[model samples]
Every structure is written in C-alpha cells, then in structure tokens.
Target chain A: MSTRRLFERETFLAPLLLSPVAVYMVLMVGFPFAMAFVYSFSNVTVGNPDFHMTGFGNFTAVLGDPVFRKSLLNTFIFTFISIGLVLILSNMLSELLTRQFRAKWLIRFLIMMPWTAPIALGTIGYLWFLDSVFSPLDWLLRTWGLLGKPHALLGPMSNMYWLGQPGLAMASVILVHVWRLLPLATMIRIAGMNSIPREIIEAAQVDGAGYYRRLFHIVLPLLLPVISVTVLFSTLFTFTDMTVVWVLTKGGPPDHSTQVLASFAFLKGIQGGDLAQGAAISLFFFPVLAGVAAVVLRIAKKAVVT
Target chain B: MANVQLIGIKKHFGGVKAVDGIDLEIKDGEFLALLGPSGSGKTTLMRLVAGLEEPTGGRIVIDGADVNDLAPRERGIAMVFQSYALYPHKTVFGNISFPLSVEKMPKAEMQKKAEWAAGLLGIGHLLDRMPSQISGGERQRVAIARALVRKPKVLLMDEPLSNLDAKVRHTAREELKLFQREINVTTIYVTHDQAEAMGLGDRIAVMHDGTIRQIGTPEAIYHDPANTFVAGFVGIPPMNFLEREGVVIGFRPEALLPAEAVPAEESMRLRFIVERVEDLGSHRLVYGTIGGTKVIANLFFRTPIAEGEERDFAVSNRDLRRFDLRTGERVRP
Candidate 1:
C-alpha cells in the first residue's frame, strides 16, 4: 500500500534491482543489434537509410571482394598469434608473481598498470611509441647502428617504417595488442595459482617429487580448469577487438594486412559509408564470439569447484 | 630406517620464533610423538625434521648424514600433512605411485608397489577413484599409504588423524601404532592430543614455547614430569596446583580422593569446599577450592557429595609433586 511496503515484496524488489541493467541493454545493445541485423539483409546507405529488403545481396557482394577475404584471413592470424604469446607470457609472469618477494607489492602494481589504465588511452600512448620516423624503437636501433649500418641485422634502412611496411605493421599491431591484453590474463593466472593449497606442494616435495615434477604433475594439472577459463575470456577479447588495429595501423599499409573483422566492419560501415555491407561484415563475427562465450560459461561453472 | 637427531634446531620466521633452540634425538625404529598445544612449536619442529622449514641455527643429522641443507626429497623423508594434501587430480593409484614414478622405477614394479601399499591400508578397491570421490577417513589412509609406499628413512606425521571423526581417529590410532611397529621405521608424529601421544608413542616429547620441556616414555613422563608445563599438559583436566609459602605442589585429579581411599601411612588431609560436580560416563569430576585455590578430583565411583559442602579429601605423600614457586619448574626432594 505504501512505497516501503511495496518494495518489501520479493517480486517487486527483484525486478526493481534488475530494471536499470535490463533497460540499458535493451535500449543501447538490443536496439543497435536489431538494426544491424535488419540492415545486413537490406540495402541501406548512410546518405539514405531508406531500407529495402535485398535478401543477402550485401553479404554476397562483400564476400566476393578480395580485400574482405584478406582481412578475414588476417583476423585469424593476428588473433591466434597474439593469444599464443599472451598465454606463454602470462603463465610465466603469474609464476613469478605468486612467490613471496620483497618487491611483490610494487611489482604487482606495475604489472596491473595496463589493465587498470584505459585501453584506448594506452593505445594512444603506443601511437607515438610506434611512429614511423620518430619511434623510440627505431631510434634505439639506429643509435646502436643496427638499422642504418650496411651489414646490420635489420639492414640499411635508416628507419624501420614500423607503421608503413605491411609485415612490420601487422607485427607491431599484434605485439601492441599482446601487451594490452597480457595484464588481464596474468591476473587470472595469479588468482588461479593462489587458490591451490600450499600443503599439496609441500606434500609433493616430501614425497620425493622434484621441482619440475611437482609443477607439471601437481600445479599444472590442478590449474587446467582455471587456465581454460582464462583462455576463453582472452579469446573473446581478441576476437571482438578492433581498437588495436584501428589505433596502431588503421588496418593499413595498403594491403589490408592487419585488418580484422571488427576493424574492417567499422571501415566499411561508418567511414566508407556502406552501412549495409559493414553490418553484414560484422555479422560474421557474432557466431564465433557466441560459440566462445558458451564455452567460457561452461568452464566458469567447473572452475568454481575447489 | 634411521635415527634423527636435531641439535639446537631453531626456525625463525622474521621475528617470530616458531621453533627455537630445540635439542632432541629419536632412536632408529622408535615412535616419538611431539605433544604440545597450538603455537607450542610441535608442528614446526616436525616440519623442520621433514625439511619443509629451514632451521635458522642447527644441524639435523639423520643416520650420521647432515641434512640441514638438503631438500625434503633429498633427505629421504615422507610426510602426511594435516590436510592429507592428496593430489586431487590423481587417482588413488596415481597418488600412491607418484614417488615411485619420480624414482623412475619400472612401470610394472611401480604399479606393484603402489597396489601393495594400497592393499596394506585396506584401500585397494579405491585405486581407480579420484581423491574427491573418497571419504575423509579413506583419504587419510591414502595419504599414509602414499608416505609408506616409498619406505623413506623417516616418516613424519603432522596431525594426520586430526581431520577424522572421533570413532575413526581412535581406530586410526590403533592401526597407525600397528603400522609403525610392522614397518619398524623411525617416526616423529606431531599432535596436540595427549591421548594420541599416550596411545601410539614409544616416547612422548612434551613441547612448550618452541622448546621441548620433557622427553621420556609415556609412563615416565606422566608419572614423573620434568616441570609444571609437562605435568599440566599431558593429563585430562590436567594437574592441580596449590602454592603455599615458597613451595608449589601439584597433584593429579585422580590422586586426590576421599580419606578412606588413600593409604593411612602417607596421607595429607585438606578441607575442600565443593562448588560443582560433572558426571562423565565412567567418572565424576568433583570441582572445589582447597584453601581458596581451585582443585579437581576425578572420582571413578559415585560418592555422597553436594554443592557448597565442606569435605575432607586426602592425597598420598608420594603422589604430590613439588615445584619452585617462582618459576613453576619441578623441584625434586
């Protein structure tokens, strides 16, 4: 009958607690997603969003193009390479951080700096760090006489043109993204490592299992469920990511070498003003991410045990 | 099997001395129970012997070999941790055979040894099951079996039976005593339970404040304690203390009984003011104050007693232990 009494009801309180998030998702995410789905099947342009039911015309046209094909292949290569490096580096870093040391607090704070800082802001900082003429990396190489020297390993180029050459640009993009995503993966790994009981490690030692044996047989096997969950989340981030490609190379060097699905979709829809084609291009990423999300949820369930 | 001698062993975690200046020697094929309350360094001393904790100052000699710098695996020791610490990911067979696998024993020999160990513990049927699928008592047995599988020089048990139910613990205590005798390996078992120490140990070392207060056969330690700490620690309801002038005297609860029970030739009478009485299954614990100091009397049979009643109790002269009033150390006559 009154405000407080009305809120006391379980049915009323439950929906009230959920309404803000539900409303935001339906308006912001749900509306755009529905529009994209419709646009992908219709002929819609930026200048004239007058939609006509075209029935997969945009999808077939986009698929036939060579640039989109190259971008699609490039997306897989970029994602897989970056995630591989992230996995190895994060595992090593987690092991180092899990041990007790004098500098642990300082080291942990510095290790988590990238994740705590905004992704877009960090990428902008990298824009200068990997510039063509002014990159500190090339400056160091030149200062060491490695790049400008005639018989040097990098060879007679005064500058490496980090963002100009197709291969170098792709490499730069992959490395930059690896650096950005590493802190998150490493934190997950550290949390996983901490959850294992200390007595188990000591028991292995007393049982005559050496250091590496304990790690491989005891630590790693117990860490599998956690590692799988970390891998799943990392996969989703890399698969849907466009910011690194956009900020570092703009999917560029003319061959579309570093272009991924997310970046190319933005280029085609918003910048190239072919909204219908861009919508169709991005639709390709949905099924892959959905599959990954499903696996992650399943692993998350298993990871909760022990 | 080997004798373990810890000479002035000390383990300091920063400023906290978990185990400080302890000297103890356990003989080959002997079962020594380290008995103490928590923070008494009983567990820390066992961990030091297991090589799990590094000693700050001491030499650990196992069969004349200095093992202070050696890793636990290199020291030829096996331990059953308080939590059992079974490899959750491994099956019972895998858990038992892990050490053999580390030794690089032949696959057939390793499996045979593992099966033998499991069978000895009556857990052969659970070999295919993972640790999570087993009950707590079975898990404890599996841990013990894993430790015994390798037949190391010394076996250290850190409250291994503490996790089991009361009925299971009692059965485990009996089985463990039998297992130790059969194996005839030197053992150092750490526990806070006096009953466990009394039941399973050939010798019980009572510890307090990082140092061993007394070490002797269970009968000797109980009958003749080195100090007040041991006398008070190793008995249920502990020993009662009464200070008079400069002398501190302690007597066991069972030692103080009705005047008719004590022998007349060595009798000392005291006026006891009864405050409460607790009826245990086989005994009645009489609570009272003798000359304003609290004392308990464990009476095995029913007696005519009431609260707030003045009663005369007797203690035999031989049963009373004398101590130094200032330091609480036993002062023998």
Candidate 2:
C-alpha cells in the first residue's frame, strides 16, 4: 500500500477504537459535571421543578451561609488530620512490617483487612459497636475499672462527642478515613522497600549506617515518589468521601457537628431541596482538590527516587 | 593491615549447603582472588568474610579477633559490590564520606579523606556528581573510592570489575592492583574470570562445589591444577580432554606439537582429522579428532592449517594428565 493510503487508513480507524471510551467518559463523568456546573447558576430547586438562570446567586448565598463556612472548615480540618495520620501511621506500620519476623504475612493480612472491608458496612458495624446503651467496649472498660460504669459510650460525657460534636466530630471522621486508607499506603511503602536493590542496602550497612540512619538517609528518600503518590490519592479519596459521615452521623446532632462539605452538599440537594446551592457547594471542592493535586505533582517531580 | 582466617566455615540454606566446611587464610597485604563458576560458593565465602552473611558453623577471624557474630560495620571491613552499589541518591563525595561520617569523624577530616581516596581512584573531579549521573567506569571508580576512604584493614570485593566492558575492566583491574599495592591492605576479591584471577591475585583459590579445589600462586594454580574441575575452569580455551584406555587424558593445547617436530623415538604420535582452524591473531587453534575422540591443539600464528586433512600431533608424557573416567579425579601426572 502507498504511504498516504496507509496513513489515511490508520487515521480513519483511530477514532472508531477511541469512540467507546470517549462516549463512556462523557456519560459517566462529563455529563454530570456539565449538569452540575449549569445547575449551580440556575434557580433549580426540588420544591419548584421549574428552573431559570440566577447567575451566581447560588454561589453567593452558599458562600454567605455560616453552616457552609463551618462545613468548609470542617472539611479542611478532617482532611488535614486524615492525611497526616495516614502518612505517619502507614509509614510506621510499613517500617515494622519490613523487618524480619515469623508469621509476618499473617500480620500484614490482618493489617490490610480494614482497608479491604466494605467501608459503609464497617461504619455501620462501628455504629453498633459504639451504641451508648449497649457498647461492648464500655462494658469491658467499666468491668476493668477503666470506666466508672456501663454508661452510654456515645453520650456527650463519654467523649464520643469527638465523633458527635463539630470540630471533634471532624477529627472522628478523619480517624475513620485514615483507618480506611492506611493499608494501601503501607502496602505501597512495603513494595517500594522491596524494590530497592539489596546491594545498595548492604553497601549502606557496610558504611556503618545503623538501621534508623539507613532508613532516614536511604530508604525514606528512595520511597518519596511512592509516598507522594499514595498521599495524594489518600488525600483526594478522604477529602471527597461522604459515606462515613453520612452513615455514621447523618451529618449531625442539630447539624451543628459533623457537617463536612460533601455531606452538606448531599443534604442541600437530596434532603433539603436546595439543589442549586448544593451544586455550588460541591463545585467549590474542585479548586481545593486541584490545588492539592498540583502540589503533589510538583513534589513528585522533584523527588530524587531511583 | 589484618589477615583473615576462615576456620571450617560452613553455611547452609535449608538442606542445601552453600559453603561447606571451607578453611582458608588470607594474609595481610596480599591480594587473594576466590575463583569459581556459578553456584560454587566463592561469592558466599566472600560475603561470610565481609560479615554480610554469618556462617552456620565454624568461625571467621580478622587479626585474631572472632567476627562471626559482628555486623559488617563492626567488623571494620568495606566491600565494593559487583554492582558498584554506590548510593544513587548521593553525590560521589557523599558516598565516599559515608563510612567516615558514620564513625563521627570531623567533617574536615572526612572531606580530606574522601578527596584523597577520590584522587587515588582518579575520580576527584566527579565527586560532586550523583552516581546515576556518571558513566559506569566513573561509578566503579567512585565505589572504589568509597571503599578505600574507610581504609579498613580488610577490603572485600565481589567481582568488582565484572560489571564493566572489556576495555574498562582491563583498566579498572590495573588501577585496582595499583591501589591495593599502594594501600597495602588485605583484599579478598571474587570472580569467575580466570584472567582476572591470574592478573590480580597474589594467591588464587580455585573453588568448586562449595570447597576449595586448589589454592596456590597464579603460576602454581595454572601449571599444577589440583583436579579436573580446576583444570577445566581456569584457562582461556580450557584444558582439552580425550578418552584413552578407559581413562580420560587431558592436556593443555599449548603442550601439544606437530608430530614432525618431535623426536619419533621418544614422542607419542596421535593422528587426527582436522575439523577446523581458528585463527586468533597471534595463535591458531586446530580442532581435530583422533579415533573419534575430540581433541584440540594450539599452534603458532604462521603455521599452515587446513580443514578436512589428516594431521599428526605429539604429546610429551609429562604434559598428559590421566584421570579416572567415572570419578574425574586425577590418576596420574
């Protein structure tokens, strides 16, 4: 075949192959995003099915709400705690796992079980486990002299308010988020450790580097790329998650505590009949996510991992 | 400098013995090469000496101090791995200064030692560059500099030049020899290459099947190999073997001569069909068969050799080695 004909044939077939994925992405992602953006600027409400252009009114009003402001702060606080805890706990766990031990695989399997279990199901289980009137932990604590009596564990004085109050509630949500995300981070770090050539480690050992010095000077620096990627992914997943909050607390006691941006947006659109305001609240999440992704990408690029 | 001794060292991985009851003494200021084929336990023996691996039984001593339980650092030995295991994240200077830093030496002293070692390896100018940013030869030099900067009494090298190309290996070999001579430290190097064993080792230990087959000076190991494995493993073309009277008779190709050049009364003549003539610049290798027994003879460059022709070669009785065919152990000189 002539070169021009061959080129033409390839070009003609290229889009045919790409069409399915393109159409799927549009249906799954592009369509909803476009709908949300358009609806945010319109006076769309569940109470009044009829809609008209409101031109940034939803954005201004959502920004003006004190609860919205509180949710934004809650979201940031939750994200910071969750991401920070995941980073630290996962690194420590991976360091422990990387050492020589009998039955190491069993420990790893148990550690990873939390990440693999269904999150909503796990949250529901936690909900029952910490129920004020019948909490097993409370009964045990009281029996063991750790608590005064088998009182309601989720009551205000029981410090379950950490999971039920505003700021502390956000911290509780962050803890759950970290529990759901730590396994993958640990696994990734372990894999990164395994990938380093044994000779390099031996060289370091012969150079008189103790275990901690070697870990800090050699292992951690080599693991930065993987750590960065894991942190970025965990940050995004934790930042946007609503299931734990929705299922555990339904976004509140008086909505005073436990209202993050994701749950607040769900409340406004699905339960509160303020669809435009909900879309506006959800859209605000994009810039924060994009900023995070940019920083992660920059850090990943600068890492000198080999 | 310290002498290292392996007292009946034995290492086992489950049921397989990697280094089985090996006993050796490497002297101070001597360059010793542990020569062997793959799976022969030379590398394992070197690792044991370096304290990278512990012996399952027996002990290792450096300067009369037992080191079997010591970590590599406490053993006071530096190793240059075959991979030139320089820290990829560190500059050449940082890599060379690692050992000194670990000992908490003053920064100025560490810098001076690092620079001097770098200069010795001819890598002084490359000290500021990361290992990944340099060429293989440069990286090899940097690894050497790192090992030398510590100035340990015993230096362990595991096939240090096996990663380089031919020309680079040759130059590195010479530089390594010069460095060892200048420093006068005891070095135990491991390699499968007999040429390197011959060139760099003050004493060459030919190893096979987790034991020392023979240990001697290069000339002794080359000219007086202990057994069939040593004979077959330690030469360029290797020793040639042929079955004779239910025994395997072997001889170096260079020991054979054209029948016409030998005195007919005293020399034995073996007639053969020439299969091929390999012209290797300064020498010619004649591949032939005598009574269906494959044999090879090496001749000078100017010899006329042709394929598919019958030729006769002579072997002196002293040059032939007779081994029991089944056991492959030397039977006669």
**What's the TM-score of every candidate structure?**
0.94, 0.90
Candidate 2 lDDT by residue in tens digits, B14-110: 8989999988999989999999999999999998888888889999999999998899889889999999888887888999998898889999999
Evaluated at residue A181, the lDDT of candidate 2 is: 88
**Model 1 chain A, TM-score vs. native:** 0.93
Off by over 4 Å in 2: A1-8, A38-43, A49-64, A92-105, A149-172, A253-255, B242-249, B260-273, B290-292, B308-312, B322-333
| Model 1, span A184-244: residue lDDT tens | 8998888888889999999998888887898889987888887787778788888889998
The weakest ten consecutive residues by lDDT in model 2 chain A span: A153-162
Query: In order, what are the TM-scores of chain A for the candidates?
Result: 0.93, 0.88
* Per-residue lDDT of model 2, residues A119-225, tens digit only: 99988887776565666766666655556535544332432433545555556566777888889988998898898899999999988899888988888888888
- How does candidate 1 fare on TM-score? 0.94
How much is the lDDT of residue A282 in candidate 2?
94
Colliding residue pairs in candidate 1: none
